[model samples]
Target: MRVAVTMSAEHEDARYPYDFLRHNYIVYLQNLGFVPVLVPNGIQNPEDYLTSLGVEGLVLTGGGDVDPARYGQENTASNEISPMRDETEFRLMQCAVDRHFPVLAICRGMQFMNVFFGGSLIQDIPTQVNAALDHRTGTHSIHVLDSRIEQALGIRVWDVNTYHHQGVHTTTVAPGLDIFATTEDNIVEGILHPAYPIIGVQWHPERPSPSPEIDLQLIRSFLDKAFWK
Candidate 1:
């Protein structure tokens, strides 16, 4: 199975002079029987490119922050904005949503989906929501609601890693979307499109998981769904 994973453009530095994908995501997908194709940062037509390559699904990987303007907000934090990456992913997501392609969005990818569906996000979780959880650098527990994720994993609660400062606004979630999991402080963690085969998790699934079995199950479930079609 060929799955297109988004890539982050690293600015030229002393060591490396060109943009490239970190091996974490590529290795993650390979473990699940997927040929991971790292997509270019700025494509003129992402859908056309994917179609030509016969990409079966999209795995939106974790990376820099999404543009605040996407969610109708002004930038007030020190978040690194990647407009080109954001634009490319938005187009890729549009094609995925339109075609009902299986999707797994992680971290900033989740935020991108929320904005694409007319949902707002907390620009800075600590400063905006004042949560007890240290979302920026702490591992925390989240309760999984009765949704796709819970159904797939057959578990209710999970302790997942965290490394983002933004989270989905539950009340402002897009129509046909449901919050499947949330932190104790009520920060959105997992989002599912009930009408579409799409799932977005705020936690980084590409990272080393504390529960290997469950993490593998999550990846397998998505792959199974994609293959089912």
Candidate 2:
């Protein structure tokens, strides 16, 4: 299986070049018997061309925050905006969804997925939610939502690291969306399409003691769907 891992651009001589990506994501995909394709940021025709090139899955890596403008919000100085990466990833998400490509979106990647689907986000989760749990800390517990995300993870409780300032905040969320995981304070930590084989998690599953089985299984789950066509 060929998995196109989206890269976050690094500024070098004023050019968005492929210099950044959580190496664990690449190594994990390779270790799982899949070819790793680095899809750089700021590609104009990311969707049709990459899809045509036989990209079976997409791994949206963590990066700077999505420009609020992408989701109808004003860009704040506080936001680490990367318009180029946002454009590339959003387009990639659309293409993957259109082609039924399995995707693993972590942190910022997850936030963009929600925004891409017309769901709103809490611009600053810490200031807005006022939840008891510290979301920026490391290795916290999460409650799994049964019959949706749990079935996929094959576990109920997960001690995951929290490292995001933004989160999903939609009262009237998109239809057929399933809540797969949540923080102790009831924050959405995971999302899954009701019928599609797509799942988005807010935590970086490829970090710390990475879950080879879970990560590969998730990608393979998508490969199982994207292939055989």
Candidate 3:
């Protein structure tokens, strides 16, 4: 199965050509048994190429911000913002949803999914949702919904890493989305489509020393849906 993982673009003046996620995500997908492809952050029309490759699955890798402009707000602070990446991944994800392909949106990927579904986000989480705990900590734990996320991960409950400032903070949900997990502070961390093999997590599961068991479980669960399809 071809799983296209989105890459992050760096400033022209920056030292590097690609962001940190380009390799990490590819390794994770390949380890999970899929042919990983890194789609550049900016593409004229990503869906066209992805469809041509017969990409069986899509994984919107982590990077940057969703540009508060997307969720109806002006930038009050400076943060990583990429329109091309956002648009490309959004289209890729929409196509995946339209065709019922297995998908996993991670970190910023999950934020875009929220905005794409007409949900708002907390621009600066420090002031928006304070909970004494660190949201950007590389090591953290979350509570997964027993009936949904547990079934998807094939595990009872497990810990995952975190790295993000903006997050979901509301009882309001996006259209046709099911809440799956949250942190101790009640910040929304996981979401699932009503009936597809689609899931999003606010935490990072493909970090340097990730839990291979949980990572494989998540991918296998999504792949299982493809097998039956």
lDDT tens digits, residue span 89-142, model 1:
889888998887889988888877888888887877787775557898868888
The residue-level lDDT of candidate 2 at 69 comes to: 85
Tell me the lDDT of candidate 2.
0.70
lDDT of 2 by residue, 1-229 (tens): 7878877766534453454777788776777787888887776688766866788888777766777787787754336576788888888888888887778777777777777877767777667776546777666777776553456557687577768777775352445666777877667787767665667778876777334466455456545553222
Q: What is the lDDT of residue 76 in candidate 2?
A: 48
User: Which one wins by lDDT: 2 or 3?
Assistant: 3
Error of 3 at 196 (Å): 2.5
Instruction: Give the runs in model 1 whose Cα sits over 4 Å from its true position.
Output: 11-18, 226-229
TM per model?
Answer: 0.90, 0.83, 0.86
**Range of the 10 consecutive residues with the lowest summed lDDT in candidate 1:** 10-19
Q: List the candidates ranked by lDDT, beginning with the highest.
A: 1, 3, 2
**Residue range 116-222, candidate 3, lDDT tens digits:** 88887777677766573578776666677647457566665567777888787655457777777777777778886767777778887778535657766765665
How much is the lDDT of residue 213 in candidate 1? 80
- Backbone clash tally for model 2? 0
